[model samples]
Target: MSDLPLRSQLAVALGRTASRMSRLAGRGDGSVIGGKIGLKLDPELLTRLSADRKLVLVSATNGKTTTTRLIASAMSGLGEVATNAFGANMPTGHVSALAAAPGARYGVLECDEKYVPLVLRETGANVVLLMNLSRDQMDRAGEIWQLAGKWRKALEGVDTHVVANCDDPLVTWGASTAKRVTWVAVGQHWREDSWCCPECGGPLDREASHWACRQCPFARPKPDWILHGDRVTAPGGRTYDLDLQLPGRANRSNGAMSLAVVSLFGIAPEQALPLLGRVASVAGRYTTVQHEGRDIRLLLAKNPAGWLEAFDVLEPAPGPVALSINAQGPDGRDTSWLWDVDYRVLKGRPVWATGERRLDLAARLEAAEVDFRVVDDIEQAVMAVPPGKLDVIANYTAFQTIRTRYGRAL
Candidate 1:
């Protein structure tokens, strides 16, 4: 394990060892792997990642991985950029990503929200992009709004040039009022989160699809950074046009956000747009695979918000599904929080639960009055998992497990 070729490999080995250690010790995580390793590694990284190369840290409750990869891709169109496509977002994860890069010009790392302050301070990023805030992993992560507030205050004190999402009222208020702020927003989506005022907590009255609060009478003013279009036209919290072939409004936002970061580095949109199409898929994010004559869409679903949006995007209908559940690693070991998600969203879909934590998830389905078959192992479960048209979503830890299992089936 110590002789691993890459940091991703090291992280994977450590993660597996930690999971087993946790099981033996009856602890959720093995002996503080992240913090312990982080402390031991913090000093060495500064000399390792020198001032010659730029480091841009991307942090968010969600969309960090997507934004990080897109930003890296957009940056590479201009020049050399090294990044960890793997989903390691914590301080340890960020360290591993940077260490793994042999001689990359820029370091683009998707950082975990809780570890953002420390990594940001250490990395001394030239640009820091803050995506929207939403409820995720209540068991491990506390209040969403509270964490957002704390992040806003901490980032404001930092000297890094801040780029933030403005569609979210919470982020908009924080960024719009901050120093060196370039706020970005999108046009109205079919499902929007800002209709209600996060301030006085009033319903927003749509003026022209742009939106302003009716109860509080606070209308949304455009951000300082108008990269391509207005908020609604921008779509998924980024400046989006029609040319990008990425699926879903979320990917569009990711493209726009990526372009914005690259634009800051003087990369022209026209030059970068064509190059973006050439970048390959960053695995485990809507990564598709065919298994045993069945089409499987593997999505990494984490919190309630992410799952709900994925449920909307998947629109599973009457198709078969394999919902893999695992509480190990970054997947949030506590299964009690499953109740918060709307599993009923799986209604009318042929969904079956799998993975080590399948029984735990099955219990939630029973409680929710949603019937689902409990197939303990993902491999065995895939036997019955629809072979033609199917949707499979595995959150955090389960995704890696399922990919390896179902990949064998394919």
Candidate 2:
């Protein structure tokens, strides 16, 4: 850091001081505030702090934080790593993460879908991981394909290597302009947002294993990494089983993507699988807490796509499930996406609705013909269920509220 400009050095110092003050004040993890201060002092602090390190940026509508964590953990065998473990995907968070670990040889930063272009331009990243794109926070992010267009323009002449999901047309089209790319066939379960061609604005020909546009040459690329049930086959036809602590097919896809990214760093899948499996929980997602003799698990689902994936990981029927929703700023000031989720799958299971927008959730559940009880308090909702395991699925702010109540703070 001594090699950096004097203004950038002072910015880093002040940012660290502000972060310490924020932690002392018990506000939160000072990632955002610290970076905000740093950027205010020196606008190019992200570029300066990111100098002389191999950087990899992970961006997606979902699973960015978990995939960043997995790639960072697997890269630990090399040396020190800098990363934002929390779900802060903006430039401020990236500045804070890089400033915090000045000596780290490698950096794995999670980037928000909208800020992908800005971060890529600033960081000049060595590798960029493009995961699935879907409709999330519609009030803020207008459409998925529009964002993909921005991504396509950003990668036009960049020298970075891209690792993209081939199953998602939006993601495939986003990485289409990159000079070098490694496609991975990570499954896409939510297909509502990507029903058409991103290139020619025509309908896509869909099949079980492949998809192509009816009006353009755009189609699914031949994948360099393919994900099967619990296994992943690499380029040379070598297969490895994914024994991960994370649950659901969604996480399996995340694992396969992480493996492909780490392989770019010359880390073999054999050496990375165990490290990926050791990650039991990310932030507060998939964490189980024992409260009053009842085991309660936390799952963060912020959109229709996220909710669809959450349902796949819930315990078997008859176990109580709690659904929580909020229209806070962090969660996007809209609840209309609730209707897109098919809650009918929970028809036979005991269901409870809680949070600031309990009525909205209750209404949606009713329309789905799934009987549910509305409980204003999360603890009360959990206690109302029989003393056993209860699963809690919530949006961004609601999940944070429960996590903080359970003594887990991000």
Candidate 3:
């Protein structure tokens, strides 16, 4: 195996082998094994295989995958491009993305907050974009600040240009640690969590529709070369509307932030705004499917914040909802955080609980006095779902499996 060329060796060792193992052990767990296998391969071979040679590493609590795909799409004109487009941004997925690409110029890697520091250290990317930092997957990802510390340690002394979200104190503070960086902020109409600084526990003040913190002294002014979108007009002849097809004001901010970073990368807002409006789908993110004439919206809900955001995007749970939760060890291994979600909103509506943790989901639903059925098999739950406007909300692994099943049905 060692005698084979580096690319061939990677195929034999990582992609084919790790994919088999990933499927065998289960889907999402394979990223760690993939990462370990990749780290064992030739490191210097990457630089040797480089051409056009610009890597953009984007990481955030949310919208990382979407932005990664968007950035990859915009940057494709530069040269060969590769990314963890399917939400594989960890070590092995990182190597697999590059290895899978074979030859590429610009690498638009959509990395996770937890994996950013390590990926940055290994990839030595030219441009790094940090979207925002928030509490996500507490059972697995822990706190945002803790992950920020890991990012800081992992990013020590790596020479690169960092474009950060100045609106988020945690993200801005993280970017502040970078020696050379530019900050981007947006004026959001929605009033969400903009009070306390992730650091110093200080009160953050809002000047424009956007905000900053003077207490921690953490809130730094936007750098000279920054992009600010004080106003946003949604796609369509709706003309002067403040809504988005993807749902919620938060996504607008995420989209706007991605626009800001794209602008920083030599793409103008005027040129990219039209492209941004063209975002059709991100696998299972608020994506609706037609099953037996019923419109099913599949949303990825893992943590409290994400679940809240998903719920916000939805307008009053239409009918019975199938809340699928994956409790497999690889999918965080712990399902304790289900309590954080306000299942009461789903009360009076019929519910079908499926996935590896159906019992847990049922328990949450039951506590809210919501009517539900606990099905051991997700496919059965999906199949048993009668027609007439049913909505399907799934998490990561569950979403993939559901897609594989229904994608074939289609």
Q: Which candidate tops TM-score?
A: 2
Task: Find the candidate with the highest lDDT and give its number.
Answer: 2
lDDT of 3 by residue, 1-410 (tens): 34447664764366557866786875653544554565566554333333345788889776787778667766655566877777777766676666556667668888878877766766688878887766556677887778777766665576888877666666766777676676655432323444677668778887654556666556655443333333443223122222335566556666665655565568755666556556656755766777666567777766665676676665465576777888654467677777777877777666788887788888888887878888887655656767666666777777677766665221
What's the ranking of the predictions by TM-score, best on top? 2, 3, 1
Residue 296 of model 3 has an lDDT of 73
lDDT (CA) per prediction: 0.64, 0.93, 0.65
- Lowest lDDT 10-residue stretch of candidate 1: 227-236
TM-score of 3: 0.78
lDDT of 2 at 186: 83
Q: Per-prediction TM-score, please?
A: 0.77, 0.99, 0.78
Q: Residue 145, candidate 2: how far off, in angstroms? A: 1.1
Model 2, span 1-410: residue lDDT tens? 88999999999999999989999998888999999999999999998888899999999999999999999989999899999999778999999999999999899999999999999999999999999999999889888888999999999999999999999999999999999999999888999988889888899998886999999999999999999999999999999999999999999999999999999999999999999989999998999998888899999999988999999999999778999999999899989999999999998988999999999999999999998899989988988877789999999999998998886832
Point out where model 1 deviates above 4 Å. Answer: 1-44, 47-50, 174-177, 187-219, 224-240, 363-371, 408-410
